[model samples]
Target: MKEMILMTPGPTMVPEEVKKVAGAQPLHHRTEEFYELFSNLNKNLKEIFKTKNEVITLTSSGTGGMEAVIANLFSTGDKVLVASIGYFGERFYDIAKAYGLDAELQDFGWGNAVDPNVLEDKLRNGNYKALLVTHNETSTGVTNNVKEIAKIADRYGVAVIVDAVSSLGGIPLEMDEWGIDAVITCSQKCLMSPPGLSFVALSERAWKMAETSNLPKYYFNLKKAREGVLKPNPDTPATPAVSTIMAVAKATNMLLEFGLDNVYKRQATYGKRVREYVKSLGLELLPEEDIASDLITAIKVPEKYKASEIINHMKEKHGVLITGGQGPLKGKIIRIGHMGYVTEEMLTKTLEALKDAIKE
Candidate 1:
């Protein structure tokens, strides 16, 4: 069978080194060798998260990391505001509501970024405990101004929790510098690794909130996670995805070796090139150019064409797999993911396939 290139918004293409490590024998989580690997992984994750906090690894998808934040940070009946720009943002609000928190959703429309001014206005009028936001909205390919949003939340004394699942490694997020309280990310996106691992880091303030949080939690208990990591031989409370961790450990070191700045530049370049080429095809973008994501591009499906037809043709005919929109925007847009181990040659091939898919 021919190998298909992944242009969907994650589980992205993995590097050969990462694949090799992942395919190798799994490690015993309790062994000293695994401890060393886990310790180094945590250190590298801190560098990637740009925080001094302990970055806890979980054995679940990115949604687990998001749920952990809600379970550990705030108690039942705590008032929080969810600022949503797209599907994942709504997911955050849904998680909070399920946890029985008094969550209010402030929708900024699907294709737009969260307006910091509008956020400030809401926070000024409400006494909320925390403000949940998504750094990159993958559904509509919009990157919110998290830095500015964090500043506004801080003035209102609301803890800022960010869902950075698809954006963390691809985009620059200064967890400490921006005063963000908590951030959640996953391995299958820009980390250049496989699925099954999600990571979360907390600010000092977030940890303090955890100490007082009365929410019910066991498996997603971050305090237990922290305790396990703080031990002499670091480990997770439960058995982790040992192979996935191995792969991510290798993949992250590769990123550090390449330099984070260069990775950001490369991702930005790919995004710009893809957007430009799509426009050259006389296509429209779902989001405005200024707020477009650097990790993915959401192109509006041209009139008289179905999104599924374009996606299926790209994959079945050309072996290039892109994705359609989610939630309300489904069937209206197609997303091209350019994060994690994507090269100019690969992108060129995918774009050519896309052009042919749309034209023919």
Candidate 2:
């Protein structure tokens, strides 16, 4: 089979070194060696998150981390606001509602970023305990101003929970400096690893709220997970995705070694180049340039072309796998993911293939 370049949002291309680590024999979860690896990974994760909080690792997808945040931070019937800009934002609202929380969703439209001013307006009169926000909306290629949103939530004494699954390692998110209460991310996206491992870091304020949280939870319980980490040997209560953990440990170390600032700059450069190239080809983008995401770019499909045709043509002809829009935007947009271990040559090839696909 031909090696198809994965330009999708998640499960991005993995480095051979990281793959080697993941392919290694699984380590015993209760062993000293595993504990050391877990301990170091947590420390590295804290640095990546730019927070002093204990970053808990869960053996689940990014959505599981989102659900865990909802389960651990707020209880049933708690009034919470979900400020949505795209699909993931709606997912947050759905999770909140499923947990019996009074989750009020205030959608800011698909191609738009969440207005901090509008969010502030809602918090002032809503008497909400918490607000959920997605840092980067992959489905629409919009990146919200989470720093400003967190500041506004702080003013209203509302806890802020962010879904940074696709943005954390690729974007600049200072969890502590921004006063974000909790942030959820996974290994698959910017971390340049496989799926199955998700992470969540909480502020002191969030931990306090968890102490009295009445939500029903066992596997997604943050406190128990916290206790496991605090143990003398340091571990998770349940067996983790051992190979995935190893892969992420290797990937995070590589990022740290390369420096987080460099990673952010590279991602921004790639995003800018892709957007400019797409526009130069007479194609349109779903979101405005100013609000576009640095991890993914969603382009408007030309009127005469089908989204599926473009996606299929890119793969079948050029061995490049891109994605289409989701929900209401499906069949209307084509998304190209340039995050994690991507290069200038890869981007150039992808753009050339896209142009050919459109022309053909």
- The predictions' CA RMSDs to the true structure, in order, are 0.7, 0.8
* Candidate 2 structure quality by residue, lDDT tens digits, 1-360: 878899999889998899899999989999999999998899899999999889999999999999999999888899999999999999999999999999899999999999877888899999999999999999999999999899899998999999999999899999999999999999999999989999999999999999999999999999999999888788998889999999999999999999999999999999999999999999999999899998999999988989999999999999999999999999999999998888788888999999999889
TM-score of each: 0.99, 0.99
Task: Find the 10 residues in a row with the least total lDDT in model 1.
Answer: 337-346
lDDT of each: 0.94, 0.94
lDDT of 1 by residue, 1-360 (tens): 998899889989999889999999999999999999999999999999999989999999999999999999999899999999999989999999999999999999999998877888999999999999999999999999999999999898999999999999898999999999999999999999999999999999999999999989999999999998898899999999999999999999999999999999998889899999999999999999999998999999977999999999999998999999899888999999998889888899999998998888
Candidate 1 residue runs with Cα over 4 Å from true position = none
- State residue 335's C-alpha deviation in candidate 2, in Å: 0.1
Lowest lDDT 10-mer window, candidate 2? 339-348
Q: How many angstroms is residue 268 displaced in model 2 relative to the true structure, after the best TM-score fit?
A: 0.9
